[model samples]
Target: MFELAKEFGGIQNPEIVVKLFSLTLMGQVGTSRFAICLKEGKSLYSKISGEYLETDKQTLFKLVSAPLLISELPDTKRYNILHDHLLKEKISALIPLQMQNEVKGVLCLGDKLRGGGYTQSDLEFIFSLSNLAFVSLENARLFNEELEKKKMESELLIAREIQQGLLPRTLPTIDGFEIAAENISSKQVGGDYYDAIPTDNNKFIITIADVSGKGTPASLLMANVQATVHALVPFQLALSIATARINDLIYRNTSSDKFITFFWGSLDAKSKKFQYVNAGHNPPFVMRRDGTIERLSDGGLILGIMKTIVPYQEGSVALNSGDSVILFTDGVSEAMDINGVDYTEERLESFVKGLNGKSASAMLSDIINEIQRYCTAAAQYDDITLIVFKAT
Candidate 1:
């Protein structure tokens, strides 16, 4: 027994321990046939020298409480199924591998080669051996699980860094325009993206998008959208035509279930003309100098649903001094309170009406603060993003 314990303790691999345990039991009990069964995840795993019987964990747990001959089980309806199976497989004895009064596995042994039944001492020793092996196997499984968890956490950190790098580091300083944007991920990585790029002829582009889903997959797709937008900027295509091409590219590359709610506009500082496309995104509120608000919603379907069947239509808005455009993802509008009630778009519009003369940065900060106050201690369930640009 001491030698067997020493041997098991020396091995770190569970598979090797199981094999050695089976061989030791066969040699010690003078049997040619043996089987070791262990539970792995939702399935049964068995190692046998000869034929094996397929039995579930529930059946084994209910039948085997201690070491005993298979024939000793009551010949009733309750034990009939397991009894018949053991008999057919030539298994004569059952030893349970238990820890903390719970059965973790079972050891089955065939008849002695000399045709004699196993004594009580032999059964006791087999039970002890089986438990020792089970402890080693469980330890190995737990170690592997911990290692996998650490690996996933490390990968997520890298993904978060990459996702953040794709966002604009500094908002372009367009003359007569004050712009401020912020994104807060609900997890280590998210799908929300925003950017401001300088273009030709005293003009610049402002873009914001919310890709479906979250985590690594969503972040990767967000990166793809950013890349596509940057690559097409030099072409200077019409807003409507450029939007259609982007939709087709996203549809061909991503699955049908994946799509992005996108809003982008080219603002000309000299003309004060904003030509934009709203691809099924939340319509940005164009609050004029007065209290009146206009929603920019004229465009085609969201990107990646299918090839652009209908050409994207452009929407033009003339921004005057003191006018502001507020754009946001649904995360902000659908943010839930502790009572599960959403802070809807109506509340946002009412709040904006009170901030007619505030700077872009102040407006953005105040809106985020209001949302945080409304949500209170409730956990954020999605990414929150906002972009506020004012014509100064």
Candidate 2:
């Protein structure tokens, strides 16, 4: 380090900088030929007791003369005289670096067998070394930038995993009924969930909720709410009473500003009975075999909307064969396009009417696809959730 520092301290030429850097980084770099025009200035540097070649090229130009040292060549006597001048001042190169594509600059090292001229092997070695040096520097810069990007990506992936865990891993099985649900979030983590829990003897509970916000906070709150409901569900209770208690739990746990639009219900698979409460949520649609549509939007204020004032309302319906109920979050209704119009309830009702001909899975897939197409090119701002219940 000290040797290079001393050599560099006495060096003062554009080409000398590259010579010093290459030598320091790559072991032994000889023959200083440099030039890369940057916003700072023209850069060309080299080493000492060496011939300094000066040229008028403002930019990097191809080396017209190859393997000729300024000190030995008599043709460019002006270069020889200039080399003498720069050497007196310890300047490494009086010449600027020039290159068009490859073979940008030239520097003649001493010949192998005496000092006739540089051999082809020596020239090849120098060229290879310089190329390696240039590539190494470029690679280092790119690698660092990529490393930072990967770190950010890692953080996002971890967040996504955690968010995913908050959702129901498996739906609860109920006798004499077919139930299935799915949710897809925009690239970032979101606040949407569905859960199946047993509420009482012969009673299977279903919940589809949309928490008000996104990211880690919403996911965390959803987890908290799920735990609370699951813990309370094991006890047999009336639909309204259970929802009221659940709302209080949520209100107590989260801030007044944060709330969830939730729909909760219990289905008696054997009896074909459905009882549910809609807390300021999208109404669940019941499609009968005769092509009749039933909107179940009976509940009161959404959970976390008030500390204790509003009471939750309850409703019930009977499901026979060929009957299906669709429950979803606001993502489907509020979905809009460049025109800024939503996929309103009327459109959704028409979609349900259209899908009466399709099977359960097909109907679900088609509805989601239709909504996505409606909002073409518009980034989805919320989680899209769908739960379809068919009486088998």
Where in model 2 is the C-alpha error above 4 Å? 1-156
lDDT of each: 0.85, 0.67
What TM-score would you give candidate 2 relative to the actual structure? 0.61
> Model 2 misses residue 29 by how many Å?
34
Question: Alpha-carbon error at 311 in model 2, in Å?
Answer: 2.7
Candidate 1 vs. true structure, TM-score = 0.84
* Native-referenced Cα lDDT, model 2: 0.67
- List, residue by residue over 126-158, the lDDT tens digit for candidate 1: 889888887777776777788888887777776
lDDT (tens digit, per residue) of candidate 2 on 55-136: 3231113322343333443446544554454445333221222334444443323222222434456444554544444434
Clashing pairs in 1: none
